[model samples]
Target: TGYGDDHTREIMRQELRERLIQAEREGRPLRVYCGYDPRTTDLHLGHTITMHKLRQFQEFGHHVIFLIGSFTSLIGDPDDVKAREILTPEKVAENAQTYKEQAFKILDPKKTEVRHNSEWLAELGFLDVIKLAQHFTVQQFLAREGFSNRLEDGNPIYLHEFFYPLMQGYDPIGLKADAQVGGQDQLFNLMAGRQLMQKLGVQPQVVIAMGESLPGTDGIEKMSKSKGNHIALLSEPGQMYTSLMKLPDFAMPLYFKLLLGWSQEDVDDMMVRINRGEVEPQEVKAGMALDITTIFHGREAALQGREFSRKAMQEGGIPDDIAEHVILSDTPLVDLLVVTGLCKSKGDAKRQIQGGGVRRDSDKVTDFDEIVRVTDLPTVLQY
Candidate 1:
C-alpha cells in the first residue's frame, strides 16, 4: 500500500519517520485510525484535516480504520462544545451514508476499512459500560477541557456526556489501533484512549494530533454548518471554490498548508513571499481554491473554477453555474443586490458604496443615495 511515486515516497518517508519513533518500538507498520461523529449533515473543510492524517497513514502502509461514531453520536460527543444535542439513530445512519462517499474524494477507499462504532457500542450491556467506565475517574472526566469549561461557566453537564470518551476509548481497544488521529481540540479524548487501553491491558494507541481547525468564511469560530460560516463538502464545486475565495488573505496560506497538503517548506516560502508583498494575497487564495477544488473535483473543474472566478470578478457578476437569482422585474440595483443574498444587510449594501467596496457593471459606485432606476438597465445588477 505504501508503494507510490517519488513524491508519495517522500511524504510517506517523512510521516513514517516521525510516527515510527512514537510507535510500539517494533519494526511492523502500526495501525492508525480516526473517528468522526455524524453530527452535521455534511462534512466541511474542518473534517478533512483528520481525513488527511488518515490518508497519510494509508500512504505509509499502516492499517487505517475510518471509524463512524454512530453510537457515540447518539449520545453526542461533547468534547469541545458546551452542550450535547441528541441525534436519532436513523438520522445518524442516514448522514453516515454520505460521509464515506465525501471522504472517498480525498481518501483511498481501497486502503480504508470503514467501521461503525454502533456495531459494538450498541451491543454493550450495563456491565460492559461499567467495565469501560472503571478505567477513568469522575475527577479525570471533569478535568477535560470541554467539561471543565462548561462546569466553570455554570453550563449543564449531563451524565451521558461522560460516556463519550469511554466509548471513544473503547474504539482503539476494539480495533487494536496502534495510533489514534484527532484534531488538537480532541487531544483530551485521544489521550483518554491511551489511558483506557493501558488499563484494559491492551497496547496503548499512539496519538497523532491534527492542527487547529480552519475557521469559516466569517473567520471567527471553527467552520461549522450551524454557524452559517461553513463551506459544505457537498456544495457545488463553484460554490465551494467561491467560498475559499472569500477567506481573508491571512487565512489563505494556512488553508494551503493544512487543507491542501502543501509541504511545510512550500508553506514557509509562500509566507516569505507574502511578507515581502511579492505575491498578492488573492493569488495565494486562488492557488488554495484550485488545490482544494482539484481534490474534490479534478484538474478540469479546478481550471473551470479559475476561469469562472476570472469572469465573475471582471464582470462584477456571479459565476454562471452558481445559483442565479432571476429578478422577476428589473428591480432597484441596491434591492436587487440584497435580494440576491450577496449583501448581509441594506446598511451593508449602502456601506459598500460609501466604502468603495461596491461596483456597478465594472464601474465603482460612488453614490449610495442614488436610486437605481430599473428603466436605466433592463437587466439586474449583481455584486
Candidate 2:
C-alpha cells in the first residue's frame, strides 16, 4: 500500500519473485519479518492487517519473525506529529507479554519466530550509535511529513526520536532478514533497514512490502486506540460483533476486502446489489460481522453474538443469558456504571447520562448524580 503507485508495486512484486527464485536455488526458505511496538496491551483490528500478510508468507513456507520492539517503544515511533510519552520498562514488558498471544489468532505459532529487538538494540553503545547516525543526513529526517509538521509548528522534536529509524533499521541486520512487511506508514523505517543493510555489508537484498492502512469505525481516520475507534482482537464475541455491526455503510466494502479477503470485484458486486435494492445493506453487514467475529472467536461464539445483537436491536431487549451484576443500595449512579463495567470511567458514565444514552430498565437516566437506594434494588440497568 505504501508503494504509492502501480509502478512501485510492480517493482516490489518483481523483486519479491526474483528473491524467491534465488532462495529456492540456494535451498533455503526466505526470511520475512514485521515489527510491532507493544505500546498498548491489546492489539486492534488495524494491527492484524500486517499479521494476515505474514500468515500468507507462512503458508508459502517462508520463515516469519514476529519482531517485538521492546527497546524502541521506549522512545515510541516518531510517526505521530508530536513526541510520544516514554514508557517504563515494566509497562513495556507487561504489554509485550500479551502481543504474541493475541497475534497467534492470525499468525501460525509453529511457523512464526517470536523475537525481541532488545536482544541487539540494548547492546548498542555510544560509539556504535554515532557510527549508525553518520549514515543518514538531518535533511532526510526533516523531509518526513511527521517531523516536518512538528518542525513547521515549532514543536520540539527530541533527539531520541531520530534514533527510532536507526534502531528499527538495525533490526533486519540483527536477524539477517530477506524481506520485511509493514503498513504504508512504516515505509521510511523499512527503507532505512534496506539502506543500513547495504551500508553495513550485510545482504542489501531486502524486499520491503507495505500493506494499506485500515480505517477505523469512523470510516475515515486510521483505526487507533487513543481515538476510541478500534476493535480489539481480544474483545468478547458479542462486543466485537456489535462493534463491527456499527461500522458506517461506506466502511463495509473495505472490511470485506481486507479482513474477509474478498476480491475487489466481489465487493463492487455486493455494493451494486445494495444500490439496486436487490439486497439489504444490514443483512450484508451482519454477515460480514459474523464472518469476521468467527475468525477470532470461532463460529459458535459468533453465532451466539449475532443472536445476542439481534435480540438487543430488533427486540429492544438484552439476551436472557446476559451477565448479571449485583450492586449495593445507596451507590451513586455514576459510580455504579463504572463498577458494573457499563462505562469505562465515572466521567464516561456521567457523559452517557447527559447524552440520554443511559437507562434504568425502560426509564431513561436523566441525572448523572442520581442515587440507587434500597427501593431501586432488583431494577434492570441498561446503557
Candidate 3:
C-alpha cells in the first residue's frame, strides 16, 4: 500500500491502493486529507492515530491535506459523543492555530497542505447550502451508532450534530481528495464523503480507516485532555513521562503500536518476550515513551524525560517539576501540597502523609496536621 511495507500501510485498503496506483502511474500525487476539529487547544495521544496515518501518507509521496475544522467546530461534532457544545469563533481560531503547530511536529510541514474549512464553509450562500444538503438526509445520520444510542438513552441529539458528517464529507469533495483517513469511529463520516462525492458527479474516493483509539490510563474512555486522562503533546517532558509511566500495563503494547508507529512484527515479538519473562514490560514501555517523545521533542528531550523519571523514582521524592510552595504563615502540610498542585484531593494528601510518602525538604512527615511557616528558603514538600 502506497509503496510501503505491509505493516506501515495497514489502514489503506486494496481499492485505495488501486487509486493511489493510478495517481502514481499518471505522475500525480493522490490527494489525501484528514479533518481535525478545534474543540481542544492541545492534542493528546488520541489525536495522533490519524496524524500517524497522515505521516505515512506523506512518506508515500502523496499530497496530504490537514484541514483545520474552524468552520465545523462552531457547530460541534457529536460523533461517538452524547452532547454537543458550540464553540465561539475566537476560541475555535485559537485552538486551530495550536492544533496546526502541534500537528506539524509529527507531519512533514513541506509536504502537508494546511487549510481552514472556514474558507469555503463560510462563503456558502443559502442556495449553495441547499444543494450540498440535497446530497444527504436526516435518516442517514440517525442510523449512526452515536445518534442511535442517544435516542435509546433518552438523550437529546441536536440538529447541528446532524450537519457534522455533511460538513466533513464536503471537506473531501472540496479538496478533491482521492482518500480520507480517520479512525474506525469515523467510518460513517468517511463513507459519507464517498457518497457525497458520488452525488456531486465525481468518483467516490476510498476510505482508509485506522484501528480503535488509544485508551487512556483508565483503559476505558478514549484519551482526552478535557477528561484529564490524556498524555498531551504540550505537556512538559517530566510530566509527560510520569503520566506515561502510570498507564495500566495491559494497555502498554496497544499504546506503543498506535502512538509509536511500532511495526506489527516488532510488537508481536515484544509480546512474545513479555510472555517468556525475558523482557520486562516497564523496559519496553520506557522505550515506547522515548521513541514517541523523540518524534515530537527530539531524542534529547526523550532521554531527559526518561532520566528525570528514573531519578525521581530512585530518590523516592516528588519530581522537581511539581510546583513548590513556600511555607509561609504556618500552613498545614496537606494544604500546602494541595495549594501547590502537588495533590489533587485532600484525602490523597492525607493518605500520602500517613503512608510516609509525603516529604518536606527530603524528610518524611508522619503527621497530616504538620504546619510550617514561610521562610526565605523554600521547603520542598511531596504528596
Best by TM-score: 2
Name the regions of candidate 2 deviating beyond 4 angstroms: 1-3, 314-383
lDDT tens digits by residue: candidate 3, 134-153: 88988777778888888888
Q: Could you tell me every candidate's TM-score relative to the true structure?
A: 0.75, 0.83, 0.79
Q: What is the C-alpha RMSD of each candidate to the true structure, in Å?
A: 10.1, 6.9, 7.7
Residue 1's lDDT in candidate 1: 11
- Candidate 2 lDDT over 43-137, as tens digits, reads 89988888998999899999999999998888888855678898988899999887998899999999999999999999999999999999888
Tens-digit lDDT string for candidate 1 (1-383): 11224553354446556667756466677788888888876888888888988888789787788898988889777745566678899989988888888888778999888999898889999999998888789998887767788899888898888988898888888787877888767766777787898887886777666656887887677887778888777665556777788888767656877787778799889989988999887787787888898888788866766665566656535445444343334455567558777787888888777787776655787876665553343222445
Q: Candidate 1: minimum summed lDDT over ten consecutive residues — where? A: 1-10
Pairs that clash in candidate 3 = 327-373, 327-374, 328-374
By TM-score, rank the candidates, best first: 2, 3, 1
Q: Rate the local accuracy (lDDT) of all candidates.
A: 0.75, 0.84, 0.77
Off by over 4 Å in 1: 1-28, 79-82, 309-383
- Candidate 3: stretches off by over 4 Å: 1-12, 79-81, 314-383
Candidate 3 global lDDT? 0.77
Number of backbone clashes in candidate 2 = 0
TM-score, candidate 2, is 0.83
Please give the ranking of all candidate structures by lDDT, highest first, separated by commas. 2, 3, 1
